[model samples]
Target chain A: MNLEIILHAGLATGTVLLFASIGELLAERSGILNLGVEGMMLIGAMTGFSMALATGNPWLGLLLAMLAAGVLSLAHGVVTISFQADQVVSGLALTFLGTGLALVLGNGLTGQNAPLIPNYDIAGLAAIPFIGPVFFEDHSPLVYLGYIFTPLVWFYIEKTRPGMHLRAVGEKPVAADTMGVSVYRLRYFYVFVGGCLAGLAGATISLSVSPGWYSAQTTSGQGWIAIGLVIFAQWNPLRAALGAYLFGALRRAILDLQGPRMILGFVNPLYINPNLGFFLQMAPYLLTILALVIGSRAAMRKRIGAPAALGEPYIRGERGL
Target chain B: MAFPISIAIEKRTADVPRWMPAATSIGSVVAAFIVSGIVLWLIGSDPVRVYGFFVRATFGSWAAISDTMVKATPLILVGLACTVAFKMKLWNIGAEGQFYMGAFFASLVVLVPLVPAGTPAIVVIPFMAAMGMLGGAIWGFFPGFLKARFQVNEIITTLMLNYVAILWNNFWIFDRWSDAGFQMTPTFERNAWLPRLSDLAREYPIFSGITLHLGVVFGLLAAVVVWWVLERSRWGYEIRLIGDNPHAARYAGINIARNIILVMMFSGALAGLAGMSEVSGVVHRLQERISPGYGFTGIIVAWLAKLNPFGVVLVSILFGALIVAGREVQPSGIAQMIQGFVLFAVISSDVLLRYKVRLVRTRADQNAAGEAA
Candidate 1:
């Protein structure tokens, strides 16, 4: 019941969501929205769990997870890029199909155990002793990707040429296309990359944190949280990471604060219900709504920030998304 | 594949050209079966044999027919739910949640003396069913209100509310609703369960082993009522106009936001009725895991039916076959994989069904109007 352990678990949860969110932000910024992250993440988690256990190799598990997700993401690219189906519904359907496929394919691996990736320290960083153990020492290697992606994503979107072009599509796909940028091609690349990151997030759950277990609800609503975080961060990766960690801490705190001996009366009602932990589980959703309400204009200022054709598919020779 | 609920979809709804429908139907079936076949083969199963099992499991016997009906009942009802609200462009994605809520309401009626204890089973069932509808209606209205008042996206709100409803219903059945016995499925009084159709017992032969409750009749009747509402009513015209061209409809004097709220409420009520029927017919009580993601799957059914109520009945049964047959697939894993593939194929075909993918043949199709038409 230590608060720190609870906080660490929450951080792990946030990291899973953060990996996916950062990738999605990259894709959405470039004016291509991918809603299949949930499905991809589920596949990743299942694949990661099975592979890690199957080969007793955590590295392979993470690799397979990413590959699985990356491959599944191709479907989204095909539908949106080639056929011009509405991205919103297509994404929704893809997620369902992906998750269902993962569950069905993963039947033999249920109740299995997974090997945890060994922890490592930054050179000379382990010398910090107490702080390192809590913040760095004992976590899986993939957990660090959460931190790396935040800043890496930030630079890629802000400093890279293709990143700039990607943003241009969101601002004006027609303009980007006129500039000789192939919208479909750019969208496919970003979506595939984003999907791999989502896969990594899922593997982080199975191989790094919960290790080896997979359920249809295993990924739960973290993918949705990533969607919310994109808005909460105002689509900034660095800010998204912060928001994810803070939310993760909140989730952990709820459980840490709960014990059979803990008194309920006189506590805040939101934290007082026996099912407070369960309801608090909906923190990401409530946060999304709250962020939207607080930054209503910020959300609508899509012309300056969001993808020009975020939920609209790109059909060549068509008028618009 | 195809989006079932676009404004452009309805205008082009003339019965597809004779050759196109037949070709597309064959294409889609072949495409679905092939994809499922390939996936099954990877897992070391024969696609041909698995598909045969799927077909037989779904249609080969009377038990299969009734079982498929049982599975399709709520889906049909919920499909009708999505059709009604979707007409106004109100996406009520929370039907699964609403269905669970309906079961909760019906359970309360069974547990609480909302009516006289000696009430006839017939009277009690309908009354409870109505109460269940109200429960879902209320849940539906909140998002409708938010969308109407603040221009909030109902898709996100409706989807989020689903988990809340599921948790709410789950907590009740797990904690307050059940007795001390470790039963996840609560037992409702005999007075609460709806009676089966008379003809079903007498008319059905030995093969039709599954229960044919009154809910099937309700599901069919719901389709008729919904078809009449959407196709014949003046309000239906408004909904249609809103769906096809909301901006023009509004310019010409349509209460856009108000229509959203009304349509959503009606949709939620119908979905709730679907849930109510399930309780009154089969499950007979509120329990954990009340839905098997039916609300979400029902969206596809609504899409496949082209949001037409009568079409919903047909499509729901088709999807229901997969769900039932999926359970009976000779070797479970491969059967499910094929079943799952069929779903994606069905949805994918709908995409091609709705839109024509032409090469960049001319500049004329560059305008919104040209592409839309």
Candidate 2:
């Protein structure tokens, strides 16, 4: 239960969440709710793991994973945007598609280990007390990429002109249209970017964090957690990083608490009842619900600044209040 | 911008016929099959042969048909649950979790050895059913209450609750109820078992060894009851009104909050019944993998049925056939793939019913036509 080790694991776990939630944050900011993040992540993980295993190149695997997920998400955009389908149902269907496709394609790769993403050791930084060993000493380059990407995404979404347009499109597509902005184009672009990041998140899991290709259940419920993180972060990339780290810490803490302990050979267990482990594992999801309950209040939402037209689909020349 | 073969889909303002949804639904299923066929061809499978087997395995014989019904029993109940919730514009994505909760509670009644061994089947059955409903209802109440009280989004809440339910079930099965290191509880007593067709097969030669259970009958009865409620009951009218426009319903002085809880509880109760039937009628024990996404599949059924109670029954049976047939095929993903495609096609095809697509000629095509003319 060393604090440094816990923080290190927390950073690693948080990177996966960072990629997914940041991508999901982008999608939600574009007013498209992609609930298939879980499915897409599973597909991405399978593709990434298999490709990496075949080619012996994790980077190419990550790229291919992104490509696969991007294509899948484009189908979602087509259904919801072009066909005007219900976003929720279409997203669920996309999940089913992703799950089935991944399972079919990944029939041969279960339990097979792939080459892991290499971690870099900063020789000079490793000597600097607690912070260095925990954050910079030993972690995958993907973790570093997350550290770099989070702030960049934050800047892009907050400080840029196109970012303003993206927000406007999400908040009021009609008004954005009157302003000569292509609402559909912006939304599509952001959604695609979101999907790419989700794919990257999956690659992070299979290539770096877990370091193997498993079944469709590999992603477990991480994608859903990422979605909740986006809401918990109030759609802010920086806050999302913080939320992701918090969740990562909680997850790590659960494992630590559940581990066997022996003090002076007395063997006092943390959780004697095995069933309590499942209940403890529920922290992340239960916390998400708690956050949502508080976040959905009108006053909190106004303060947090949720998009006004978050889940509403936009159509050209539609008259409405 | 001039475009060639551009399809313009415009929303229709006129009233559509009552049969339009059903017609479009069939069309979507056909379209899904065609799309899946292309996928099968790409993957080097003979689509026709595969589909033939699918048909044969599901409805080729009386036994196959019986198996299909067995699968449809849970589906029908879950579909009814989805129908009720969706009618109020409430997304109860936790039906899978609620189903698990129901199964757990129902299992607890028998596994805990609460009732005596001499208890009659009639008494034991209804008690477990009630416990299952209560379990699912309590689970459903959280999201409904959160949504009504704080305007929390039920979609996320319900989805999150599913994980909680699954974990909760895992906790019990993996520990307290473990059947000597196995990830399941001991088998329920005979009194707790739902009577199956095979039970009577011993005396009647015609009904021999069929897996068909009373659950199918319960499903049919539920469909009828749901249809009556939705078509005739005041509560159903209120739910529909809320679904159409909650603001309007509230303006008309309806208690939207209370109705939300009530409807969600009712929906969860049916899903609970599905879970109860599954444990009592099929598995006869509390174990891991009780449902293979029946709750999620129910959403597809509800949508395919256009939220009609009768349609729920038929669609459930159709999906049941798919699940049953899927087992006979290589790479079992075929059934799931088709289900996914069906959902996609059905959702996309909704546009056809609501809008008219106009194919416009591009500038090049127009110029070529002008030149020809």
Candidate 3:
């Protein structure tokens, strides 16, 4: 109910959504809309959990997650970009393949606890008694990465050479091909990098944020939310962070709102019930659909944004149907 | 000049025969199997023994082969659903959701206790399944409508519906999860079960290994019906024309928007029947995890079959063998590797169909003109 609490919840959502959204932004930016992000994230989460438990190292677990996701995502990039298969189908299949692999491999970490990412104090800021804990305490390095990576990502795209190439390949691959840019090379790079970003996002869930082991549905629909985040942010990294935060707040706010209860039945019921809870749990998913629909409207699609060349395969010297 | 030679090469590319693409697909699948065998060997499983066991186990016995056919029924139906819609460039990826919806509605029909004990068994059974098909078709229509009207991506809408269907099922099941009530599944009346063909199988050798329910028969029938529609009907001609080139189809007086919606709905209906058929036939009731991601696998099936209904039958049966074989393999995880490899290759088959990679030589135009290379 209070402003501060709402702000706090928003901050949490931002951290969770930013990781996957930013990765998707990069993938879409290359005109390779990867639907396998969810698959990669789930694998990343499981791998992160296992590595953390086995080695008792949180950072190592995160690294393992990224590696795992990167490898899994290769199939997607190869089939979708190299073979020129339908991007959406390839993405969906990658998800199935990844999900299958994760479940099979995640058997070891089932019901076992893994190492957690701990918050470290800032050198000077932590000593500032009241404001210090509120600002600096209870925040992990992963949160900092989510925040700091935003502007850094924006700069890379708008300012750098390879960044320009990535955007060029995305916007007009044929033009880039005419300019002697290797379209396949650029696509492969972005897809692989996106895989790494997705992996990091997965680790954030299992290693740093939630800080424990979970299986299968562990990543839940965070990957899809990340996809939604891409549309919500209009392919902008900084805006992506804001959108993620908004979603995360929505998620925790519903959980934090079970204070008072209603009768189970229409008439004066015998007991208070969480029957309304199913709708509550579905709030995030519903919100995502609404966001996608609103964002894709022609009047709004360009405004909220989708990558111009998203899902279009680039073929040089030929535009044959 | 070299330019004239280049034109000759391009002409050759255009002249490739129609059956060549399918031949290439089969070649790639075979190549994938050979490579995948190496992966198995590295993982310590004997490829020869494992494959032998897989073949013998899945096709070796009557009961096992029948189980394989049963398993493939839903996959074949869903694959057909995707093939039809996707050919029209309408992606209906929510077959899993539609399948569940079909199951949900069919389950509703099954739960009714009002049917008299002496009522004709044949009448009630088909009616139960019809509701399921209707439910799936309705689900498919909405996304198509949305895509046509609002320019929304059918992919995301269908994907989202998957969860909606899942939650809908959960909402119903939660009510039945209480103690003393059924947990995993509530039993359906004996009358609703698919008529088993175990008896008919003993009398017919070709069908001996198959103990099919009505669903398998319907699946094959549906495929034949779809094949006929796609090949001989006016609508099928329009779909092929639209898929090949919408501009031409429009010039020929085809309604593009209507076909998109129509194709997707029909696609959804078949997929829905797939889900419902399983419940009314094999499972006899809805349970948690009713489908083993059959909707998604339909993509692979469609691709493997090259969108041909008869091909879907062959590929679905092949996949059925894989699934049956996958379970029977010891230390079972290796089967997934085989599946992943096959799917990867099947999807990648499109590449060979579209392109012919050739190594170029910088020889003079005179040499190029005389050589087939």
Candidate 4:
């Protein structure tokens, strides 16, 4: 109900999605639709939690998470790009692998807490009323890092030379290859980068958001939501930030509305049967379908900004261009 | 064109031999199991013992074999469902959701008193099956319609719908259908339950304690029907043609959109039947964990079986073994890991079926004049 509470809750929740969507956005822009984001994130979460728990260093955990996921994504690239396997099936397999690996590795870490990512507060910004508490006060350093990276991502895609090449690879791989651009290399690089970011997203959940290593469902469906956010954001990092926050807000609201209703400073419980709370959880997924349906329809009539060569493997001089 | 050595990966000019697929498939499975065995060893478990236990638990006794069949029943149905749509190049990833929808609808038949308590088992069972199929078909229709109408990606739509279906089911079970706060409906009346193999044990002692039910029969029957349709029916021709080349199929005047919807619905109906079968035969009541990822596992089944209906049956049985083995094993995730590896191997092995890769070193000194030299 209040601006400060909502904004605080929304930004805290949104950081995970933001990290994931930006990574996926980058991968998609390079013409590889990696559906294994969820899997990678889960693997990342498990590895990060394990590393952090072992070393008592959350930073090390986060790094290892990115590394593990990057390696997994490379496997995906090899299958989809080099072997010409179906992208969708390969991605799904990657997910299953990640989930299984995470479950196995995470068995020992359940109910155990690892080091938490430290929260930072800006001196001057924290002093400001309403705005300060909502934006700058008592948030994880990862949140600020995400804030800085969002604009950087936008600039990198919009202004840099490699960014232009990335867009070209996604839109017209054959044409890009003809122009001396290495489509294969660019796709491999972006897909790996996406995996790294997904790993960080997982770290964000364990180290900062939930602040502990849990079971296989720790990352839950957040990775899938992030994938949906990529389309909802129209493949734009800046817009993805907004989309993530919107989803974050919806998620936060559901949490606040359920339970004892104390989060809203109300006495009466908002959930009538308490099971009504479960149905409310369906909103984000329902919203994703609606967004895809509408976004794709608009795309047909106008440029909805999808990379033209998305999901298609580019094999040099293969036939039937 | 002669060089000291060169590496080339070229498409094979000739068609692959008939035995290649089976050979590669068996090779892949063996490779996967070996890798998983190594993993098991690394985890401090004796791989041989684990595997031996797996074999014994899945096929050790009549009861164990019957349990495996019970597990395979849904996988076969869902696998057949996926094969149909996938054969037509339609990605029906919503099978999990459709399964839940089917279960939801089937639950209503008994929960809502749609039929009288005294209704014959024969009557109520078929009605529930029909309702379940309808539910799954309707779930499939939305993504099919969207793909046909708006070109929305079916992969995303189907995946998203899965959560929606799951959450919707949870809502009902937690709120209205909870049997004294338990996350399940009350046990169905005996008349509504699918007759278990043990029910026949009254006369035959061998049938005792065998949990196998009519679902396996339904699965086998469905597989035969699917194989017949795909191999012999005119509709199968249209579906196959579209899968091979949609542009050519469209040029040939096939109604691509309608066929996509139809095939997708048919695919969903099978998955729905899987769900209904689970509730009616195995659980005998709608519950929160009605399936343990059977729908997703069915994807692996369909692919591993090469989308052949009979292959689905065989592969489903293999996967059913894994499911049963997982329960008996110390670590449940090991079985899941093997399934995942099997999928990876299956997908990667396709490259071998289509192309041949050979490594050779290119001599830089006199590559062009090497033959003359």
- Best DockQ among the predictions, by candidate number: 2
B96-176 in candidate 4: lDDT tens per residue?
999999999988999997998889999999999999999999899999998998887888888888988999999888778
The two-chain DockQ for each candidate, comma-separated, is: 0.29, 0.53, 0.30, 0.52
Q: What is the C-alpha RMSD of each candidate to the true structure, in Å?
A: 5.3, 3.3, 4.9, 3.2
Clashing pairs in 4: B5-B361
- lDDT tens per residue, model 2, B156-273: 8888998899888988888888899898888888999999888887789778868899888879989998888888999889999999998999999999999989988888888988
Error of 2 at A189 (Å): 0.8
In order, candidate lDDTs are 0.73, 0.85, 0.76, 0.86
State the iRMSD of every prediction, in order shown. 5.0, 5.5, 4.8, 5.4
- The fnat scores of all predictions, in order, read 0.11, 0.65, 0.19, 0.65
**Against the hidden reference, what TM-scores do the models get?**
0.88, 0.95, 0.87, 0.95
lDDT of 1 at B304: 58
Put down candidate 3 lDDT per residue, A112-201, tens digits, no spaces: 878788876567875676555544556777776766788999999989998898888888887777788888878888888888888888
Clash list (residue pairs), candidate 2: B3-B362, B4-B362
**B1-373, model 1: which lDDT tens digit per residue?**
1432323322244555656643554466567668767777887878778778777888888777778888899989999999898777677888977887777787778766577677788789888889888878887887888778766667767777787787777666655655674435557777888776533556755534457688888889989998998899988899999988888999979898888888888888888888888877888777677677778778777765667788789878887887787666633334334434544555565555666544443342244423332
lDDT of 2 by residue, A1-321 (tens): 567777888889889988999988998898898888987887789889999999999899999998888788887888877666788899889888888777767777877878778899777877888988988978988888888898988898889999899888888888898999987788788878878888888888999987776766678788888987787677888989998888887888788776666534756355466567888878888998998776566436477656777778787766633
Which candidate do you rate higher for lDDT, 2 or 3? 2
Higher-ranked by DockQ: 1 or 4: 4
lDDT: worst 10-residue window of model 4 chain B:
B364-373
Off by over 4 Å in 1: A121-134, A263-288, A295-305, A318-321, B1-26, B198-210, B329-343, B350-373
Badly placed stretches (over 4 Å) of model 4 are A259-269, B1-7, B359-373
Off by over 4 Å in 3: A1-14, A121-136, A159-162, A178-180, A211-214, A254-276, A298-305, A319-321, B1-12, B34-49, B112-118, B176-179, B199-211, B250-253, B328-337, B358-373
Query: Cα lDDT for residue B65, model 2?
Result: 95
